[model samples]
Target: MVTTPRITPDLSTNVGALRLAFPTLMASGCYGSGEEYAPFVDLARIGGVVLKSVTRFPRLGNDAPRLVPVASGLLNAIGLQNPGIDAYLERDVAKFAERPCAVVGSVAGFSVDDYGYVTERLAARDEIDAIELNISCPNVAHEGETFACDAALAERATRAARQATTKPLIVKLSPNVTDITEIARAVEAAGGDALAVVNTVRGMAIDVERRAPMLGNVTGGLSGAAMRPIALLAVWEVAAAVRLPIVGQGGIETARDALEFLLAGASAVSIGTANFTDPRAPVAICDGLSTYLNEHGYAALRDLVGAANPTFLGTR
Candidate 1:
């Protein structure tokens, strides 16, 4: 069921099928150890591997200057800590379970039975294929961004994390919204198969010579490259109000900024603070999207996903 990223830019396929390898992934708590940046690159040629939020217990996060720097990006609140959920199924489930790609597992909490006890304890493990329901933990201190800005508490925490698994859940939306399409149609009417639009944008910085606030938990979560145009205008307004499938991430670093969230509809993409400034930035964004599709003859990579929405329903 997992065929070598299905020939060029598979970025690993299967969202409902769940495989995946080429849509170029990585955003969950920003690569703490996708093989520790694999000594500078080669995370299975991009399209899978999203760990770092594991929790149902261990977490010692938040402290230090925690992180803060602006004028284009950088402000974190490192609170989802980690190392919980039975030591993340014991030290990152067998080192990303015999790697190759596709590992997604980013959970986090604050109710709904702690997101169904960490989604039935990481879906009883198979080395997780998908379950990224962080629900945007904006530096905790009161259960991340108000249960991700309402939407009926984001559809009761995405239907208690979709009755705690069968894999593939992905609901991470929370750009401190006012209406992120009412929390991405309330996690696609409480079943959520995909929607990782954004998860960092609450900001704050003021170290005016030690004059207070600059992280250390005073409010953070800015992300890089000045959050590329508000994360591509919220992945082009939630990929024209959801039909599902979107993995875009804020301030992507290249491959033409991951083809501008796949021409504003995003079926896949996430680089996050250029992996701390380009540890081979996703193999230079997969060789700059295969040289921008061999100089535009355009072929694979889902043939340019969304293909640039045309005004997406005039002035909404």
Candidate 2:
């Protein structure tokens, strides 16, 4: 008898009105043009898709030496290069608006107004379901990092962004912090609806002969399997402290990886670096999770959320 992964899910539910087949989703910057990847895999199969970070204005990003290969992962200073908000709406965002799957727009800016102005522009458009704030863009300005690292500054930026739009706000926090909980709470107090934790850790590499940094930007954010444990831990800490829903992501290459985030208190999970490894990663995860659920007798994906939390690990 031939058998296949079942798309049917009884546990099809979520933290709010957002019901999902499984908690799997694609990380921002992972999936290329929706129109481009459409041939490789069904982007809509996942819970949602976070578009690459857009800015208030178009950016060409950094110089040629922007990507470097590290032992465990890839370091990138792509510089959030994208056409400004207007071109994005006319081009990328408009394309996805026709799809039934949730479209999460990711944004970045150099200053407080950069963030707020971007949000306001997105709010005026109904094409996106939510906005994922990339306060942790590691490539360009030191200012973006400043907002992400300081608790007070993080709060101020979040509050300003929150005031700009009524859309669901999800703040992506950097993993470089010693205490992620402090930043998470600040977002909650400032009215962020959800969180996408642990943005890639900052790192650098050197070219021996050139005696210069490998990446044109000198340093960049690291993403891939190497960041899994740190990402999981950060998600766990933030989830435990904040009541907001979380979209856990980083190095999620397989179904088990997605489950790890769900157990860590993430309402949904995002696939980042793995996409570079396998373009079909997100669809594979969606199908893999459905099979896991049907085999385990769980009715829906929601039932699995936090079921594997350490608090539930050793039971009599």
Candidate 3:
């Protein structure tokens, strides 16, 4: 008797207009420009890279002790460090043209107009496949995460960035808000193409010996395995509240963690703090996801998306 061959499961998924070959993206800030991890992993095998957030002007970032390793996670107050939009456009964007995977530019700003200016400048580049409006960065001072916390502010910022560029606009929301779903709805109404749920949870650490806060900024954004549960719930809620695709993040470190987000309703999972522990985690996740799909008799990654959520309202 002849046996039939089993076909490999498809890992492809769509984030707005960007069709990712894989449903795993190297989260912004942690992965840099994808150049840092080029030596350790094959870029083409993963989905894409959300480049570090660029602002309208240069920032010195937080002082020393910006990172503190806490129980099951990390506390970071990097302050959205970048060379600013003008310098970034002049020296950085050209390098992304050769990246094997899609390049999504991240823009962070203090005000609505700032989001528009930086987003327009970055998305104008042919090298950038999409734009991630980082309205939820907790590390920065002067209400950086304010846009994501307030529904009206989120709408204004998304609208401003939407008017700036025709590229796919992904609004990154904050988990520190009172109601993340409300903000998600506002963003969708403001023309956002997708949503990156749960940036980082606001937290802090103290050193008794030094009699001071562990992080220079006093408060920091917490990420890693610790924030996984919070991020997952945010993704589930946002997925039910809006029809836009969701890129779930926070403290994902392994295939199981990524799988949890997908089941919760994220179309894709962004790897962040996990890279610090293991650079090969992204590739491993892709392999593990394929195995899980095949073992469960699923045909593609999209099949697993929102599998556990009854009220999921995404496009898939």
Candidate 4:
């Protein structure tokens, strides 16, 4: 009897002080606190689960019609609607802690103090493996001017969070900037452990028949396959600028998309909007990645990271 060869590719990775069993993570806001997806996908199959951004106070989010479907993407102005940090810690943290995978808590605020407060609170929770600072939300403080839009502001925010927590800090950056590398370097210098490159791009949709906007917020963040190229560029630029690990994400929908991000310089990849289309997308990508690694004679996932870089290939 002929037997199939056992394929076991090392998919482990490290982001600063935090080590993951795999290289694919469920993006923030895509999987809530993970309870919602527990009935659908295997929560422990992926590297980590990043919870949705939680504020100091419960939010009602924007008005009606917050999500709209585009050709190759989704436009959403959900406004970070979530229960306050206290509620999350009291009700959700334990649930996530019970899981056998890494749990990454996400925090967002309107000011430095707000960021610091949330970070400090989450740092006390042993259940949380890391903290993802969401500095890219477009409808937040400073008259909707995201902290990621300015290098100085990004550094200030990172500094505040760093002082507040000893947990691994992953700063999520915005793509709506003049030079993303400046913000990336500032975050790294300010003690950020890792970076999550290319948050949803700001975009708008209209209802021609109604002569109005489609999203309630008028302008929403665009995500899905449409943002992959822009996300790749951001990862390429930021990876070249900082020595810190990167969690690249944008419109990743398959294993091939995740591979592109890794080759571009991401230590790990985050599956976002694709989760909405296929509940099993993350697990499928993980399985497919293993197959690709074995077929290509790659011993580990890290071997593929930044493989496309000219400097890494000695082609520059």
Q: Where does model 4 exceed 4 Å of error?
A: 1-6, 138-144, 311-316
Candidates by lDDT, descending order: 3, 4, 2, 1
lDDT of 4 by residue, 30-95 (tens): 887777888998777888898899988899899869999998999999988988988888887877
Q: 1 or 3, which is superior by TM-score?
A: 3
TM-scores for all candidates: the values are: 0.33, 0.90, 0.96, 0.95
Better of 3 and 4 by TM-score: 3
- State residue 70's C-alpha deviation in candidate 1, in Å: 1.4
User: Scored by CA lDDT, what does every candidate get?
Assistant: 0.77, 0.78, 0.91, 0.88
The best candidate by lDDT is 3
Model 3, 232-269: lDDT tens digits are 99999998999999999988887888999999999998
Tens digit per residue, CA lDDT, model 1, 1-316: 8543322333344555566657777888788748888777777787776788776788898887888768777899988788788867866677777767788888878776788788788877886778888866432544454777888877887898899786788888877788898888878899888888787888888878989987887987898889788878987898788677788888888888888887777777777777887778887888788767756666566667767776442121
lDDT of 2 by residue, 1-316 (tens): 8985555875343533344554666778877646556778775676777788889999999987888878878898898889999988777666776765677788788777788999888766787778888887432445335677878777877887899988888899999988998999899899988888878988999999999899999989899988889999988888778778888888888888888888777888888888777888887877787788888877677777767665422111
Model 2 earns a TM-score of 0.90
- How many residue pairs collide in each prediction? 9, 6, 1, 0
RMSD list, candidates in order: 19.0, 3.8, 2.0, 2.7
